[model samples]
Target: MENNSKKIIHKGISASSGKFYGKCLKILSGEHLILQIHISEDEVHHEIEKFENTIYLTKQELESTIQKFSKELKKELVEILSSQILMLEDPIFLQNVKERIQKKLENAPLAVHNTIEEIAERLSSLGDGYLSERAVDIRDIGERIEANLVGKRSDYTFLENLKEEVILVAHVLTPSQIIHLDKNKVKAIATDTGGKTGHMAILAKNYNIPAVVGLIDITEKISEDEYIFIDADEGIIIQNPSLNEIKLFGASSKTDFGDSKFKPKKIAETRDGTRILVKANLESESDCDLALKYGADGIGLYRSESLFLEHPSNNPTEDEQFHAYKKIVEGMKNKPVIIRTFDLGADKFENEKEENPFLGKRGIRYCLQNKNWFKKQLRAILRASVYGELSLMLPMVTSIQEIIETKELLKESKDLLKSANVPYKRVKIGIMVETPAVAISPDVFTKECDFFSIGTNDLLQYTVAVDRNNSVISDLYNPYHISFFRLLVNTIQIAKKQNIPVGICGEIASDTNFTILLIGLGLREFSVSLPLVPKVKKIIQVIEISQAKKLAKEIMKLSEEEKYLEIESYLFNKHLLNNLV
Candidate 1:
């Protein structure tokens, strides 16, 4: 801070939503402790053996961490940390270190450091900030190896104790750091690294800890015990705050997130009595409280990836997966639990390398290729189905053959269960209508699948050929693209014609602005982020479904490109929508 009297307010993107006034604790980055020294030829062989052991132990540790951590911790995020495992498995990385030890007679730790650091330095040469950040992953892997080489393992145990509450700031916040952070002590979180949808952010949200990320230099700007106020909803940080700012923040904090009155009524209905089925997208049983708090109709999309992530070595054992499914199904209180089976990257399971992993063997394709794992999950879900109204959903179904194979496998699973005299219930089968081929061809899947959940995120990405993860051309991945709406309208029309219950269960469904538009498009079932359900309910309670239909009718009429602008203008206009915002 510049002075005692002066106030400084900085803004970043909100990673988690809440408000808090506390002292900022700058969590410094871990330092690498590799010494550059050439070992005697006598010790070179020993160093080589030590290096090999470290790699095995580090990979084992990564697997153990996945098994130990709460299922609430995102399993998909393993891809981030799993990159380290890939690096370890990379022959070049291992060869570089070994050659350094053998040929250059360098110490194992020093050899590992030089090899990894050199690679990291190369990644740093790339101009892209995202790729440049790969240096951190390299360093993280190096640190793990370096620690193991020194016969010591690294951890975040030091963060468990705090004298007072603080806004925890870090140069690069890891998922492990988020897990070890004491919620009572850390009132908020700020990081120079991380995005809103990153694993750390999701964990922070689960803990209800206010967090802001992508600050670039927040750790550089603040020191330990510096009084600061964080408004994570806006991703704003106030330094050297005035008394008035504190007072204003005090009142604003109450309504900043959902307080008492903000809770939604049990049933959501439009002005003219158009009842909408409002549900939540959940990761694990841990999110049940928030879903219930927001009065969710059911668990819309229970991504089953977490359980598979738990057993990163292979697949979660059937019993392990069964317990998890049962808990979530029972947690939802028999409403409905739609579990989407392992929608993982194609590169995850196969020995084949994919230049374009997204479009390769993924989701249902991966399951079909690995039927043993698929059967394990099916049997588990079937066993848990008796616990509640459970539904099994398949991801990335471009053809009807995938569904047929799944049904055959599912029947096989039931037969095995029946042979063993194990009790189970037959669950409803659903397919994620995301592939462009199937999104507009609902008539094709109508006979095979029991229900449809339009995964707008993948649907939009595949239809427009935009990779949402790529920063470049991501702007072109518009949900309101005329063709997107056209495809969505057609999918819904065909499904409705066949009397199939369909709903939106993608990231696009979370936007409150789209609530009216979705309702207008004849989508009465909405499974959005749990926190946003209350807001969507409020929107539902105000807008007449009649007006929603009118808005949809007009949006469909705008056949030209940049039709999204016209739709946005329509929605944002105060006079047109009339308190719709």
Candidate 2:
């Protein structure tokens, strides 16, 4: 890793935390050239068999990976990789490729690649016509199966067999690509393409690796085995650093509570003795223990749709939903748990197509349209409510009419349970304040819902009119934009005026400096990815409310042009921990 060159720095989006020094390990990606080959009628049957067998092999690999890394990976990531196995077993998917090989006399690789390309294109047609989350999954799965058919080493296996500890760089890396990585040897990651909300970023955070993406041309810039320093905390990279710079950085990394979750975990409180609610956004019951381990104040978002999605048919029975909800509620032992009802749409679930799935029927709108399915989930949640403090949260709610209708359904659910002589409890209801309609008229919503959780993921997208997944314009989807902050302040103030509780449940990873900014804006609760509980707590424990308020006021006063100039200085400053206040 030793080098003799001028020091250079590059900036990118910070996808994970902690800094490290290692030799560069560049992973080059190239298109897998599948030459189309025609064959005789007799060879067509053989091609179909080969295609089926290759899928079986790929399925076995995915299963083994699931069993092997189940502990290290978080529940959501495990689900993502598990989705690949489902793809391999899909009867229609298998039939489609077999049809191509048999009818067109195509080779197994060519048939498989063509079917995948078609499906990927079809998936991209959903929700703004970009590469949706599911499209990426399909494409990654295709790469795996195609590689298996051609007798090539899979991406994870090649990367897993590395001989030395190093920083990995690639044109791009999918969550599927990093499934079998050797965490011990792969010290950090740098990539040429990715965004904060992409699956890779979520996985990188779960695995606790230092990662920076969206460098655009970093793969071409960095050479193999070169010494480089990754300041992932600030999304900065330094190449061929002097020994003096290395020593200074190395010393700080060691003492930064470098190992383990923060020991002596207790209630999170700020410097001025104000308590902060650090909640975990739970999607699966398996993560309940992990949340408790990290001293989570409560469950901020129990995405009940995950349970529905987990079912092979994408519809779990009432008992199935009840048990899962009950388990998470009981595990928390009386701590508040907020469960969001099914948030599925055409883009996410198997259903009739829409011109714009994200803007069309989704969340409460979908549930309302299908009342029977909606009531079943409501009854299950009502049943689980008695086990502990559980709340029902409606997602994508833009109007008070949705709340009124949902209440009527809740009453029907209770009546059904009452007729059956089943026991249940009435729980507080909440709404995810993500839509611009709600933000535009915040006061109207405060009187209806018990509380609000600002879902910044969708809010930022709906308000900014840019999809964060689209790399071409994702740069413009800024949380620090003056318009975004104005809307945020408006929502927070309206909720405060009505004496309603409010907090944020998304967009923490996009900007590390925004934690205090949120608190300064009067947000008291933080329901984040479970892995970030300790990091959030550390920030909350250091700063006082007064200082955060002052910073918020100053930032709000800046013009759009002046705001970026001033915020960039604070954003790029690497030593904020020591001088946070």
lDDT of 2 by residue, 420-449 (tens): 999999889999989999987889987788
lDDT, each prediction:
0.78, 0.79
Q: Give a tens-digit lDDT track for model 1, residues 1-581.
A: 22345566677767665567877878797655667788898998888998998899989877776666646454445565577688889999999999999999999999988898898899878754445556766777788888888876465556767778788888886655666677678888988876655566667876777788788888888878888888675567777765434443331233222244554578999879878999988755556766886789999898788566535355678898889888888878888999999898757655777899888878998889989978999999999999889998999999999999999999999999999999998788999999898987899899998999999888999989998645345457677688898888888999999999999987667656567778888898999766667777877876787788888777777645566657666654424765333
Task: Give each prediction's root-mean-square deviation over alpha carbons.
Answer: 13.5, 10.9
TM-score of 2: 0.62
What's each prediction's TM-score? 0.62, 0.62
- Model 1 misplaced regions, further than 4 Å: 1-203, 206-263, 312-314, 559-563, 572-575, 579-581
Give stretches of model 2 more than 4 Å off. Answer: 1-264, 509-511, 574-581
